[model samples]
Target: MRDMTGLEWFKSSYSGNDGPECVEVALTAEHIHIRDSKTADGDRLTVSADTWTSFLSHAVPRV
Candidate 1:
């Protein structure tokens, strides 16, 4: 795993203030860190930058 000490995590802007299902994402040099905002101490999901870009591209299609 890569060091994420300096990674800046941001919650999805679309997420509501009291949203139950919220995710936090941090970009690192090697991979993107994804974790549940509700369970920050829980395990995280890491994905390569390229894969993350592709995933987002499909997850949120351009209208």
Candidate 2:
């Protein structure tokens, strides 16, 4: 894994109201990284930016 220490991570806007469970996301040139906000050093997941975009397109409800 490359040095992602310089990457900026932010909480999901959908996370809502500082709950026990939260998710954080960071982006790279080609990939998006996700991790549990409660455990900064815990397990994380990485996916392609394309895949993340596709996921959001499908997962988000349409108005």
Candidate 3:
């Protein structure tokens, strides 16, 4: 795992302000970092930019 201390994490706008279920994401040149917003110091998942794009293609709904 890379040092995430200086990473800028962001949560989805769709996530409710009152919820603990929010997910946070940070992007680096080599990978995309995903972690639980409620547990910033916990384990995180890292994927390549291509993998992240592929996941989003299937995960996001098209208009």
Candidate 4:
């Protein structure tokens, strides 16, 4: 994982304090960052903004 310093992370709305699964996301001008809420200092995946957009399109298509 990189420095990840200055990035603002937000938890998914679907996540809850008692939930077993938690995801955190951080958005930058050029990329999107994903990390496990359980391990803030653990591994993270970084993807290009375009790639994230593509993923969201497939994951939650418009009605």
Candidate 5:
């Protein structure tokens, strides 16, 4: 995983404003960084853009 310093992170729109289960994401040119919103300093999961898109395709149901 690359250094996440200076990266701008955002929470999922489905996340509740005061929920502890919020997930945060940071995007870079080469990878997507995911981490728990409540633990900014904790370990994060990083994946390529293509991998992220593929996961979303299966994880999110078709409308």
Candidate 6:
């Protein structure tokens, strides 16, 4: 992972504080960045805005 200089990162409130399954997301106009909370600076995954929205829609399921 690079410096990530000015990326804005946020965590999901639904994810508990003491879970290894937690992840953090960073947003930019061009791409969305995702990384494991436990290994944030190790490896991060990047995706487009459209793909990110699609992922969230599927990952969260419908209410």
RMSD of each: 3.8, 3.6, 3.2, 3.3, 3.4, 2.9
Question: In terms of TM-score, which candidate is strongest?
Answer: 5
lDDT of 4 by residue, 1-63 (tens): 235498898877777779757888998999999988778899989999999999999999689
Which residue ranges in model 1 land beyond 4 Å of their true spot? 1-6
The CA lDDT at 7 in model 1 is 62
Per-model lDDT: 0.83, 0.83, 0.88, 0.86, 0.88, 0.83
Per-residue lDDT tens digits for candidate 5, residues 1-63, read 234498888887887888898888899899999998788899999999999999999999999
lDDT of 1 at 56: 92
- Could you give me the TM-score of model 4 versus the true structure? 0.81
Error of 6 at 53 (Å): 1.2
lDDT of 2 by residue, 1-63 (tens): 123488688876777765869888888899998988788788889999999999999999989
List ranges where model 3 is wrong by over 4 Å: 1-4
Q: List the residue pairs that clash in candidate 5.
A: none
Question: TM-scores of all models?
Answer: 0.79, 0.79, 0.86, 0.81, 0.87, 0.77
lDDT of candidate 4 at residue 39, scale 0 to 100: 86
* Residue-by-residue lDDT tens digits, candidate 3, 10-54: 888898889999899999899999999888899999999999999
Model 2 residue 58 lDDT score: 100
For candidate 6, the lDDT comes to: 0.83
Candidate 2 whole-model C-alpha lDDT, 0 to 1: 0.83
Q: How does residue 58 of candidate 4 score in lDDT?
A: 95
Question: On residues 1-63, what C-alpha lDDT tens digit does candidate 6 reach at each position?
Answer: 244477777788898878888888888888998888888778889999999999889898688
Ranking by TM-score: 5, 3, 4, 2, 1, 6
TM-score of 1: 0.79
* Candidate 5 stretches greater than 4 Å from native: 1-4
Angstrom error at residue 45, model 2: 0.4
- For lDDT, candidate 3 versus 4, the one ahead is 3
